[model samples]
Target: MKVLHFLSFFGLIASLSLEAAPKKENRKPNLIKPSETSQTSIENSFPKPKDQYQIRLIMENDAFGGFSDQYYTNGSRLEFNMKAGESNPTRRVLGYWNDLFITPTQSTKYLQGFSLGQEFYTPTNIEKADVSYGDRPYASRAYFGNSLTTATEDTSITTELELGMIGPSVGGKSAQMNFHNFIGSPTPQGWDTQIPNSYSGALRTDVRKFYHRFFGTQYNLNLGNIQADASFGLIFRFGNVDKTPGPGSSALQPGPPILHEDGTGYWYFYVNPGGTFQFYNATIQGLMGSDKSYKTQNRNTAFSNWDNYLNNPTQEAGEREIQYRALAEDNGKNSLQRYILFNEFLVNGTSNPYNIGLNYLLFNNIFNGAEDIEKSTRLFLLNNLAEQWDQIPDNARALAIYSIFRPEGGKLPPQIRLYSYEVLSQFILDPKQREVLLQLLRNEIEFRDEKTYVADLKRAVGFIKVGFVSVSNAGFLFGVHYNYQTIDFQSGKGLPQQHQWLGFQLGKVF
Candidate 1:
């Protein structure tokens, strides 16, 4: 009964947090500071336009952090003082202008305001050290009246790489190569894989749309070791016009437009029923705009398919069975959080990366009795990938479900038996293609125990064996061979509470 109630609770939590709610967007007063309204009309306030220069300073604070900027209006150029490292007095000078020299001509309407001022090229000095000079990697933008603008920016961080020259092979000095290898096991505790992060830089282009249902699109060309990917997504509002803005809406005023990590925004004004927005984030908004959820929603959708689904196909028996082989898993990593995923790398690719890969195996887990076959294979993968080469204990079973191909595998109690593997097999494609897909079933093929070694040197070299224990009226149910097996929690030992490890034990306790 305790296990039953716990399973029910786990199911409830998954349903609640994974669902998405409708979102809307629009422009608010924050974009154009209310106080800055006076400056827009300053030219007209005076009788004759004399030689008067304008100097403006702004300061802002928010949850993430704060920034201060100073702007001067003159052909002579502008200077900027940034207070990023606030705790310390060592502030940095971001830019210095040589009289707005690099700005486009005055008549470039719609985009005339955008320019990389001369000051942008000056070296960035921090802590009396010059990290970057006159290299304004930051892009420029110009606002066009009527809720539109165009901008381009490069948000790339470069990493220096030093490779080795051809080694000493003057006359065949014995061919030998040195390489570093990193592998991890996935436990319920978390990602056991130790992934080293890399520096990333990207070129961004954008177009802003800000009227109703604020929309935009952005394209990032990330350089360096980071993964390359192109993704499109959006956040739209759906509600009665009279309803307040977003989560921060008030009773008296219309809801506020959606906001991004940065104060900048690409927003739609008022959106009522019958309103719809389907576009790119880079379209109307500048490169840096608000659309955090867009990326996450896409990631979530991918996560939805990461696990195995109990799919029982209604196909007749004796039909051709499919096989999938990962000639080699492109375990490379990339920048965009989404790019790190396998599906994203495949689905978002212009050319199929999976067209030719390296994985070796025969047969797909699609047959009528595939459940038994897969359950058998799953234990092997789990044991081989574990800290100690043995089957997962009853208590750590939730952690065992971290690998792919099991939907009902999430942190569930071991009383369960998988019902379907068909739903998952459809994803692998044709029968021949399914061959060599042993990575999912045969993950531990590279490993073996003493019994396996003594059985048959060649054939048994690549197979792994695991154990299982379950509790019933018989005190305990134990199985020596690899199959859908179980172990009891609370009791530190395997089933029977005597010997839980495989290879050494044979037959069942019952």
Candidate 2:
């Protein structure tokens, strides 16, 4: 860029000199005729100028190989400045003529050659292949047009290389590892471009990176943010990712365990990124419920109940052995499982931040293997959906919920699934004000149904759920939900209106 600036300054002076050079007449150069015919004819036959004038100018430039000034005139201009390898002007100004041919052939040739030399200074973005009309070097020593067209107008260029650490912990191969990038571009005035700045940081187990790519997604609005190739329509993304422990790490150190409100099922969302992100989502599950020591997985709930303490009596004594035998007899089947419902609603309206949502196991009537097992599971799920849906994000809605019960485990039927999503939100509008902040919440599937279900609902029990969720950015989700419990257990039946909105939640206005 500095080179471009210097060139422009020279351009200004050269332009002014061409404009002010005297253009009237010139005094003839005193010359002795060559003694011989060969030289005599050429010297005498030279076209006599209609007018000749004295030309003189002093100049200084750092562009050439050196810095110096010298005298020059019509006769001397062609003999010295126009001579090959001699045009490195110490300081010289030549005359211009209106008659195209009047400018001696030597001068014409010199200008043409000089102009071509300037091409070396042409900016790379603008292809030299595109230039035409073979201009005389004298036409524009300033290269003003080329400068405006490309950043390559400079005669001198400088480049610098850089390397640095990035990410969470600032170490060699820890999280703070990154790659280096170099850029070659032009500035508005004409000059090469290079990387100006960079940085990195780590957050907990996550590592983050930041650097400029030549072309990113910015439309070039903010030049410094993206890559050089990104001049027109570019995009650059700031990415931060976490390190995943090896497999079975979750089974070992699951971040936080999710317990079912009821005693039946234990829900846990494992954060494992070893190879892929498995949500461990709601998979259809089932277990039989009964008295004489609840039976499940051939295990009697006589001892193993704690969600974390998996080390139960190893001796396999009393009902424990019986439960184990029963569980072992089931052919290692997934009897205590939960299912997922595809469409769960969260926050429903434009202004209502406090919305409702649900996580359900939408039973496919066609695939319901055992009607008895499927119905019992579906009923347990309906009650859960009615209470938990539309109560998380506050703005959405929920269609249903899925619940699983294992009778053999001596645990109560528990609600195990809930649906939620990351949604963009807007703050309160004054009937007209626009929003500023943008929020993104991604709801990914971690679990799916992979097994057959079995068992039956002993008797339908109804309950109301009262809870409010204050989500980080979207606001608080509220719900007042209730479901019908069977007054008549035998032939289960209830009026549609019998359901009630037992609870409700207020939302965050901001």
Candidate 3:
């Protein structure tokens, strides 16, 4: 079948690509530009370094036509630059610097380097039941990858190749079946109600591939003041849709199995190995940086680039002038201001920002490399925090606060302390709330001390949900995504499902 051949081709490509990566890295030439090799003033050579960390909150939808027929998505991607390479200065054809400096001075010509991070999102299905027969229910996946960036005078473009996996999608679809308490009798629908035990079974099945692979490349370009990005990739699926059978590869496993409660019939379920290739694009414009210190010192500007003012601007022309100047100097808008503010104002503290000084705890430390238990606990904490940001129970909040402020034997890490302060000091518009938070941080709880702090921080990593909303205009953007997917057995037969969407978007970045 065509599907089988396509899967084979992709599998081969994946294997070859992984095998060939290191060889290609070794083959890269170490030669650098002759002009840039010459020792120039450090100040002149290095442009202002971009922030080491970037957090992007993006909401994408294919609802340009109407809300009734569309695909919706919401997510955030956070990136951290582990190593930022140097920029390659432009060289003339036969210039003096090129002639005088012939030896290579750098390992690569790229201005920027790579980043590592996570992307998390949820996609939902909302098609009409009568007209549409597709089912694309909401699901979440966390993807991690490294993105390589190329920086120029007025532009910086980053390309990222990332992969993610998901397990069984219907493990909770039949939770009401209770096999233990059986009092069956014939009901209206010819099903047992009481005498014969009106119960089927509480069966939970999980069938998933070891590598429900989703690999794709995203190109994000910041051109002058305009920002534009696009990505294309595939989602390859091949695995068991049921329980794992001991120690074996997922490639050798079949799909899920269906069961009948009355032992009347049994059927096997399988999704032929297949893939879906998708692409997305968007553009935004606005203020780019929100760090006041960075701007006043680096660009000699006295204005802040937060979106709060732009969205709720005053009628005064003078204030508007100040905003315009700030925008011009900042180059672009900071898309994550609200996200930063949420952390600084609502998420981080000895207690919830609104409930400070309530005898909470804090643990500020990191797990060592070998602390597997601590690592797992941290992951669990992060997942819970992300999932229940607005509805976190008081007890969970207390536990998180206690764990984050937990102390070690000596001083806490400088970065940890600084980060705590940074998140604490911004976006506090209410005096009472500010006072309570400050009091909580400055004072200590009776039972929480150095010993408790050390133990907790060593065991669990601190985490919180940071949210933001912004408006920007970077460039013109439009896109379409179509998926010809196969659904589970429909009326005892397999059927093809179709999903399509067209979107046109425009925004700013600052």
| Candidate that would win on lDDT | 3
- Give the alpha carbon lDDT tens digit for every residue of 1-510 in model 3: 655565567568867986886655447674765344333333344576443322222222223323222112222233333323433222221122222322333421121212121211111211111001111222223344334433222122333334432111211111111211132311111011001101111111112222222221212111121112221222232232222111101100101111111112211222222332112111100112311111111222112332342344555534544543432221112213423433443446434443222111121111110111234555655565655556644544544554443331122333333234334334332565445444443332111121110000011111111111112122111112222222211111111222222222222111
Q: Give the Cα lDDT of each candidate.
A: 0.20, 0.20, 0.25
Each prediction's TM-score versus the true structure: 0.19, 0.14, 0.21
Error of 2 at 30 (Å): 40
| Candidate 2 lDDT, 81-125, residue by residue in tens | 111122422112221211221223332212111100111111111
Looking at candidate 1, what is the lDDT of residue 219? 21
How would you order the candidates by TM-score, starting with the best? 3, 1, 2
- Evaluate candidate 2 by giving its C-alpha RMSD to the native, one decimal: 35.2
User: How accurate locally is residue 99 in candidate 1, as Cα lDDT from 0 to 100?
Assistant: 16
Query: lDDT tens string, model 1, 1-510?
Result: 655565557557745754653444763444766346445445444456222111111111110111111010011111111112223221111111111212323321111111111111000111111011111111111111111111112111111111111111111111100100111111111001001112223222221222343322222221212212232222233322211121111110001111111222222232111111212212111122222212110111111222232132334211212111121111111112222232333223333222111000011111110111245556555444454424323422333342224432122111211111222222444554333232332322122100010000011111112222222232221212221111111111111211111111111111
